[model samples]
Target: MAALTTDSAKTDPLIRITDLTFIYPGSVKPVLRQLNLDFHQGERVGIMAPNGSGKTTLFYLLMGLLKPDSGTIEIFGKPVRSEKEFENIRKRIGMLFQDSDDQLFSPTVLEDVAFGPLNLGKKPAEAKLIARDTLNQLGLEGFENRVTHKLSGGEKRLVSLATVLAMEPEVLLLDEPSNGLDEETKTRLITHLSDLDLSYMIISHDHDFLYELAQSNYTMKNGQLEPMERMHIHYHSHPHTSHRH
Candidate 1:
């Protein structure tokens, strides 16, 4: 597989949202309204906002699970006009929801992690190798045979990440990754996420995590994203701005 090179990558924005708006079925007010944003390759961005601020809805829209009422979305410089385009881009993007349980539905961790690559038509043995490698990368060496529901909350999250990691996506989106995690697990997760080189977009209210892991930060308020001066500031400068939140 080819890494997204800078020259070739620059020719196409990894994500482009222009005047995007979305309204759920039978809803009067638009959940997302006239949003404009752009994401380039190799950037780690943090999206911050309170609950009911359309954070999850934006994630769903980006994943192409929901279509906008009237607006434009481009993934990898290709126009997202139909389901075909979405299908093409979906393979390149991996998304993890707020709840790992939502993603870890397979009976066993190994089976769960292998599901994505298997669905992509890889042979079972090949998928198994990918799953095992991903599990090891996340420091889960022998829990592959364990039942997902039996694992601890943190372990389940790691399994969830392994599932997406097997797909080798160019872009990774994480929503509330630290939710329900213990201190040790949260630290481990932060360390693992820090080492990833792919383009990443993370939504969290955890200021410390964002300050440390994100190259840029955007706050979603009133259906728009505003960049604060602190986006370029070093992590130590803020001293955990989100601790009270």
Candidate 2:
């Protein structure tokens, strides 16, 4: 299949894949077949597909959380082939997991948010500064000493996101970011994301949210990802509930 690509994807790829393929353990069929994609700098891409279509698998592969069966993944012109290489690549990219609880563990929100920077070799004071700045950026300025487990779902989501942002990555991968947020919190999340000037991809089941944020969209099917257009807004608010594939 011809992969859909943006103009910048062809001219200046920040994340490039060539003939990517993968199969899960204990599975007979390959989940991805010669798949190709190019995520460019400063692009806001939304990836969507039906359930169990390997959307999350693709994100995991890009982050080197899982190794591909075949093909090359290049970031910033360097091909990732080893753990050391991926470690370097990860410093430039931050991935937010689907579960907020999985990312937040420290007793206090500030400590949890500072974890990434601390792990990256920053001093405690420096890491705290980054964490505070990140939280402030996300409209959580006074949440520094709050108990992490006591926050609402939306607060947890924002705090988890702040953890990733504190790393100061050039690229962000947000998966199911709006999962547990209420409409008001979701709107706040959207506004915060809109103001972040960076290259990123959001994987979501929420079509309406994706439509508002993504400049380009794609859907995965039959082990391939291809371009898709946003369905007209009127179709959603009404009962139709259909979308482009």
In terms of TM-score, the best-performing candidate is 2
Q: Each candidate: RMSD to true structure?
A: 5.2, 4.0
Model 2: CA > 4 A from native: 1-10, 232-245
1-245: candidate 2 lDDT, tens digit per residue: 24544545467799998989999999988898888998888899998888788888999999999999999999998899888999998889999989988989999999999999999999999999999999989999999999999999999999998999999999999998988789889989889888988899999888767876888888888888888865632135446445443
Candidate 2 colliding pairs? none
Backbone clashes, each candidate? 0, 0
lDDT of 1 at 74: 84
| Local lDDT at 8 for model 1 | 49
Per-residue lDDT of candidate 1, residues 75-181 (tens digit): 87777877788877778899998898899999999999999999999999999999999999999999889999999999988889889888999999999988888
Off by over 4 Å in 1: 1-11, 231-245
* Per-residue lDDT of 165 in model 1: 84
| lDDT accuracy of residue 123 in candidate 1 | 99
